[model samples]
Structure formats: C-alpha cells, structure tokens
Target chain A: MQLKKIKSLIEIMDEKNLTKIDYEDKDLKISLEKSNISELEEDNEDGWIISPTVGTYLDRDKPLKVGQKVKKNEVLFIINSMKVLNNIVAPRDGIIEEILVKENDMLEYNQKVMKLG
Target chain B: MIKKILVANRGEIAVRIIKTCKELNIKTVAIYSKCDKDSYHVFLADEAYCVGESNPSNSYLNADSIIQIATNTGCNAIHPGYGFLSEDYKFAKKVIENNLIFIGPSLDVMEKIYDKQKLKDVLKQINVPLIESYKLKEFIKSKDKNIYPILIKQVNGGGGRGIKIVSSPSELEQTIKELNKTLKEKFDINNYYVEKYIDVYRHIEVQVIADKYGNISILPERDCSIQRNFQKFIEETPSSINNKKLLDEIKQEALKIFQFLKYDNVGTAEFLVDSNFNYYFLEINARIQVEHTITEVVSDIDIVEEQINISDGNKNEKETFITPNYYALECRINAEDPNNNFISSSGKIDILNLPSGRNIRVDSYIYQGYSLKPFYDSLLMKVITYDKIRNRAINKMQSCLDEIIISGIKTNIDFNYEIINGKDFKKGNYKFKKY
Candidate 1:
C-alpha cells in the first residue's frame, strides 16, 4: 500500500473511531491496528501482537528470543487451538523487540504475546 | 467431585461463586474479555483467562472458546452463574458431551423448559394454572377479540426485553411486527406469542433447589413488583403476602412443576399474582438469578454451595420447605441516569465507598479507579439489607442507600433511595403500574 493510502486509512480510522482496519487489493494487502487502551495506565509506544485464541503457544522450528530480527510474513509462532495448529506470521519486517510469553505457555485471546519494534 | 470450576460469567455473580469455591476448596477459573482485564472477578479467581474482545458474541457467548479454555485449564465443571450461556441447553449438552459437568439443570430439563409451548403443555398436564396464551400465528388467525389487551412477547426473550402490550385488535398486527423485528435484531429469533395481559398483577417468584434423586426444596417467595419497563428495581423476600395460605399455595405450585420436570440443581419459577390472588405461571429461569441474593439472606442458605453440592450428586435425598427468618430487600444500583429515561453512563470511578453495617451486605465487582465500560449491563452493585421486622428492613435499606458513595458517573442511587422511602412502599402494597 502507498504511504498516502496508508495515511488516508489512518485518517478514516480516526474519523470512525475504529480500533483496526484491513485493506486489500489484487497485489497488496495490509492490516492496521491502533490501541484503544488510552484509558489504561500501561500504554506503550511499540506495536503489540495479541493472541487470536485461547490455546497453547508453540514456537516454530527454532525458539524465538528477544532482539531477533524478523521479516514480513515470516512464521513466528503457532497456536494450537482445538488440535489445529495456526501459524502466526509477522505483520511487518522488524526486530523481535520484546517476547512477553514463553513457548508452550497457554495464551488467552487478546493477550499480549510479543511486542514489535 | 468437581475440584475445579470454570465460572462462565462476570461481575458480582462471578465474585459470588468464587467466594463459595474458596469455602468449598474448589479452584476457580474466570474468563474475561479484553476490556474486563482489570475487573474484580479476574483478581478474585484462582486463574483468569482472556476469552476474546469486548463484544459478547466473540467472548462471553462464544461457547467454543469458553469450552476450549475450560478443557485447557483442567476444569472439571463449568458454573454459568447467570445470563450468557447459563440457560442455553445446547451449551449444557456440549459440556456433558465433553465429559465435564454443567453446574445447573440436566440437558433434558433445560430442553423441556426452554421450549415455551412445550413447557405450557407439560404444566397443563399437571394442572398448573398458566396464563391464557397463543402463538403469534395462531392468535392472528383467531377471530375472537375477547382476548384484547394481550401482551406480545418473544418466545426466547427474558429479562423484560421483548414484550409489548396491545389494547385492541386494531393495533395487534402492527405491534407484533415491531416486536418481531426487535427480536430478530437482538436474539435472531422471529417467534412470538400473545398472552392475556392482566391489568393489575404482582411479580412474585419461587426459588426451587432439587437434587439428582428428586429431592426438591422450595425456599421463600420474593416480591419483585418494584419494576420499570419490566426490569426489577427492588426485590424483597417474605413478599408482603399477609396470607400464609396463599404463600403456601404458591410454594406448592412451584414444587409441583419442579417435581413433574424432575429438575435438578437450583432454578426459579416465576408467577404473576393478580388482584384476586389467582397465580399464573409465567416461566422458569433455568439458572441462578440476580435476586437470589435476598433469598439467601433471609433463608440463611448458601444457594451457590447448594448448587455445587447438587451438581456433584452429594445432596441429601429428601424434599423440604424452608421458611424465611427475616425480611430482606435488595436494590440494584445501576450506572444510569434516572432523570434521562435511564440512559446508561460510563466513566472511571474516582471514589468508591460501599455501605456496611449489622445486617447490610453489598455484592459488587466495582472498585476505585474502575473504568465503567458501555459494552456491558448498567448494574453496578446490589445492596441488600435485612431485619426481623419488614418496616425496619425497609428503613435499613433506606439508610444503606444513603451511605453509598460512587463518584464519577450518574447512578440510580438517588432514584432507588426515593422508591424505598415512598408512601406506597411503606404501606406494603407497592405496585409497578403505580410507579
């Protein structure tokens, strides 16, 4: 997505008071999210990845650690939800800034799994 | 035995169940949406998990997610305190299929009671006096206009949501369409029924607790006539029913219904007692109710503990009726502006001072700095007061309401304070229609 288009989407999000939005076309796809926890005390500047289901978290082939560099769409972890393994990929290229959860830990939906920078 | 229970609810009821679990040495697991991360229930439970987003469909009503969390957390049973999937027979059935106990009525009892038409038929077989009712389609086809001033209600609607009063045949179809649309948008169910609307009636309900071995216990009746828009504002036990014979009759009728259905665990049977004291069976609430607090205070019984014991098949096999020792009253404090048609208000609580005394108890999940969210119900707390004398109990409730201090939002505290002190309430004949 173009920078101008992304800015416009952010503007739309602000106008509609939406927490997240997804845009896609034939060639490119983008998922944007913004924090609605302004009232909460623990607000952070870095992007946070949240769990999508209540299940056990498992690392891919190798264990992931903090400060590890990651690429966009790379398989970062898998969540075993109801016996089905769901691969959670990186939303964008960034270093593994903070790992909040450990491998084999049970994850609840919307729980903070990792932070990206 | 149930060593661990997943409480599939939130707010005061979750806290209520956790207190009992602590007493019984059963571990508790609480599920919350993201918005409820800082809720009191989360802090009180042995283990807490985020179910989903703030929307109930993705979180509280998400049966699959709830079941997954229970199985993963090693929960031996699930206690749906009230609302959400508490009365959902399908969810109860799924829990049994997954080899976990559902801490409520059996699947067969739930199925029979949930079907409004079938419930009425069963009651008819047992000679229960039910209100004259008809399905929406059947009522529309009938040419008889004698049943005018009928109430159009959603078959699946409870808690005073989908109900309308039509005075004449001319407005019957229009009201039905409106009710159907509202039901469709809310419950996704398009079915409705019409019942002969009694112009003057008192809302009284009986609490019944049964075991697997057909042992049923009927507690004291509660008078829930202090209502607005069909939602109860104040619930009192001993019911202000001066006649002991009438009270016994109501209990007998409730016991008969439970015995016929072979209902297990704790549930409520609601009735509409009219001017002449002719009681008409309304429906059954197949779960623990909000007003169960007052009954517990008066009867000196831990109903939640009883529910746990019954579900575990440890209850004694004998039927008994318990008379209340005190007159107890409960007022639900909601975060709503009574002056503005009860529109809900939400904000961070700056100060919280709950009332406490000799016979006063407050059941709530709010605390200082708690951010009241708009996504949930407006009820903030339940203030209960009890005494040997009914008048003294009302006076105690009036003083208790005055002592409550919740800042940073519009609450119905002042509104409730006025109701308890009003002349009608003092006279012991308060009517909802008059309110």
Candidate 2:
C-alpha cells in the first residue's frame, strides 16, 4: 500500500471511527487498529500491555525480562482462563521497560502485566 | 466469608448490589457487555470485564463465561440481582459446584419454586392458602364443572407469557388450543394448568428473610396493587387491609410457605387478596425484589445486607428485624412515554433533576449525559418516600414525582404523577389494568 493511500485510509477510519479496514484485489493486504495504535500512541513513554481476560498469568517460555529489548507483536505472556490460553502480545516495538507481573500470578481482567516503550 | 462478590446482573439492580457490597467492605466485580461499557454499574464496580457481545443470551445470560470470570477474578460469591439469572436454579447450582457462593435462596427453594406445580403442591400440604389449580391433562381427563373466568397458566414453568384468561366454557377449547400452541412455541412445553380467576383482587406480597439456621423473619406485607399489565408500577408498605386479624392471617400464611420451601436468604411470597378479604397464594420470588426498597424504608431493615449475612451463614435475625413504624411508597420511573402508547424511549439523558431532601430515596443508575440502551428493560429509576402516615407518604411521593425532571428522553414521570394523583390509588381500590 502507498503511504498516501494508507494515510488517507487511516483518516477515513478515524473520521468514521472504523476499527479496521482491508482492501485487496491481487496483492494488497492491510489492517489498521485505532484502539491499539491511535489510543496507545498518546502515552508513548510507557506502553503498558494489560491482560484482556481474568485468569492466571503464565509467562511464555524464555520470556523477555525487564530492561530487555522486545519487538512488536511478540508473545510476552499467556493468560489461562477457564482452561483457555490467551496470548498477550506487544502492541508495538519496544524494550521491556518493566515486568509488572510474574509467572503463576492471578490477574484480574485488564490488569497491567508489563510496560514496553 | 465472602470477601469479594460479582454482581452478575446489570443496570440499576447491579448498581444497588455494588453499593451494598461496598458498604460491607466487600470488593465488587462487574461484568458487562460491550454495549454496556459506559453503564454505571461497570463504572461503580472495583473491577469490570466485558464477557460477551450485547445480546442478553451472549452476555448477561452466558452462565459459563460469567462463572469463569467470577472464578478467575476471585469473587467468593455471585449475586444475580433479580430478573435474569436470579431464579435460575441451574446457574445457582453451577456457582455452588464451582465453590462460589450463590447469594439467594437454597437449591430446593429455587428448584421447587421454579416449577409452579411442585411449589403449589408443597404449599398445599402445609395449609398455605392456595387457589385450587388443575393440570390441563388431568382436567381434560376428568369430568368436573368448569369454573368461569379461569386463569390458564403453564404447569412446568411460570412466566408473564403463556397466561390467558378464559371467560366461559365457549372459550375453553379455543383457549386450550392457543395455550398449547403458545406453550410449545414459546416455552417448548405441552403442559399447563388452570386456576379460578377472581374478578377483583389486590396484589399483596410478604417480604420474608431466613437465615442459614432456619430462623425466619417476616416484614409487614406490602401492597403492590397498582400494576399495569401484571407489571407492578407502584408499591407501598403497610398493606391496605384494615382488619388486624386478616393481616395477621396473611402474614402467617406467607411464613408457612417460606418454611415449607426451606427458603433461605431473601424471598417474597405474592398473594391475590379478594374484596371479601380472602387471600390465595401466588408464586414466590426467591431473590431480592425490586420493591424491596419500600419495605426497607418502612421497616428500617437493609434487605440486601441481610441477604449477604444469610449467605455468609450468619444466624442473628432478631437484631436486624424491626416492626415498621412508617409508611413508604416506591414509584418505578421507566423510560416510556405514556402519550405515545407506552412505547419505550431511549436516548442520552440531558439533565437529571431527581427529587432530593429528607425522607426521599432515589435508587437509580442514570445520571446526566448517560445514554440508555433500548436492549434492556425500560425502568430508569425508583422514587421512594417515607413518612409516619400513608397520606403523608403518598403526598411526599407525589411531590417527589413532581420535582423530577429528566429532559432528554421521554419518561413515565407524568404517568406516575397521574396515578399517584388519582382517587383509586389513594383509596387503594383499583385492580390491575392494561394502562
């Protein structure tokens, strides 16, 4: 996707409050999320990654610790709720600024787990 | 000892439960649908989660998800505040099986009361004043004289739906045909029952509280006769019956029904009182009722607190029970426009000028700038007033209704004002109408 076209698409999404949009005929594939990017970008100093479900925190194997560099979309930890595992991923590329929780810690839904910025 | 609780219902009732929990130093966990993100209950809870989509079945009624969230959030108890899953015995069983307390009546009370037939049978053995009921199958099989103007109701379960009044023998066959069709299509059942319908009756219900130790306390009965289409709109403490003997008889009957069911926690036994002072047993509501606030104001008893203490196995009841020395009335303010054929009106509340000052209590979740959703019940708030006399209570309630001003969406405030101002309501001589 062209930069101008993507910017216009983002503007349209913001105008209409659209969460995601995709257009493809032969080779173009794209998806944009306003809640993740636009909302989180306002607080850039500490990009807090919170649990989306109430469950027991189960850190992924070989998890990145505090002060460690991490990348966007990286699997940081897992929340096991009702026997279902939910992967908590980094919303953006950043370093592990702080680890707010430890493995096997009981977490309420939306509880802060880590800070990556 | 429930340190934390999850209010598995929403709107005003959830807010009510959360307030009660806060006072008891118990943390509250709320679950809401995506549509209810801005709901007051969600904002009031110590913690909240979006369990499912907006649909009731997907969100509030999602038993598995609700239980899972309660389990994960460390909620020691789940209070299904009236309606929804309050009377659902299976949901209560699920909560119990998961080691979480279900804050309501016992399993037997829930199971028996849910099946009207079983509850009726249980009440009958204990000499509870019950209106005679015959199953559809049995009535069809036997040769008996038909009671004119009978109430046709489903035997397996009871709901406002699947209820009709058959006036004469001419409508018996047709009423049965329609009853069977409605039962099958609406309830997926083929069983039903019929009871003799009285022409004029006043709706009275007794508020009963039982402890885990089986000590039961009955509050002075409330007259909820002011109803529209079987849905109570106004409820008042200190029933209209003047005869002390008759009132005591009704209260005794109510206690008997509660004991027979082994009911624990807070419950209400409704009755149909005829003009001649005869009362018959109606269904039992095994949860905190909507009109409990009126009884609370009059009796000076916190019913919700009592319910929590009972669920916690606390046995002290004599200290909490008090004879009501005041008269109180609750007017349900709904988001409905009476001039518009009572159609539900939903929009952002622009300004909320509820009645304030002494002797007035408004239990509501709506505030200025709150947008109401059309997916749920139309009730907006309950305006209650307390005084030493019924006339004073009624006058105070009328003034309370007069001082209300909700501008954005239409409200039934005016309709309630008319009812409170009407002669029939003051005399307590009105029957249920389709107003």
DockQ values, each candidate: 0.56, 0.16
Candidate 1 lDDT, tens digit per residue, B255-322?
A: 98998999889999999888888888999998999999999999888999999999998874534798
Which of the CAPRI classes, incorrect, acceptable, medium or high, describes model 2?
Answer: incorrect
Please list the residue runs of candidate 2 whose C-alpha ends up more than 4 Å from where it truly belongs after superposition: A1-81, A84-117, B136-145, B152-162, B166-186, B190-192, B319-322, B432-434
State the lDDT of candidate 1 residue by residue for A1-107, as single tens digits: 48888899989998877789999977658999998653221223356777888888998899788999988788889999867899988877788888888777889
- Candidate 2 lDDT, tens digit per residue, B34-151? 6899999999999998776678887798887799888878899999998788888889999999999999987877788877766788777777778877776666666565676788
- Across A2-97, the per-residue lDDT of candidate 2 in tens digits comes to 777789888999897678888554655677766655647533335777766556889798977788887777788898877789887777678888
Error of 2 at A89 (Å): 13
Model 1 residue runs over 4 Å out of place are: A1-47, A60-71, A94-104, A115-117, B143-146, B179-190, B317-319
| Candidate 1 TM-score over all chains jointly | 0.88
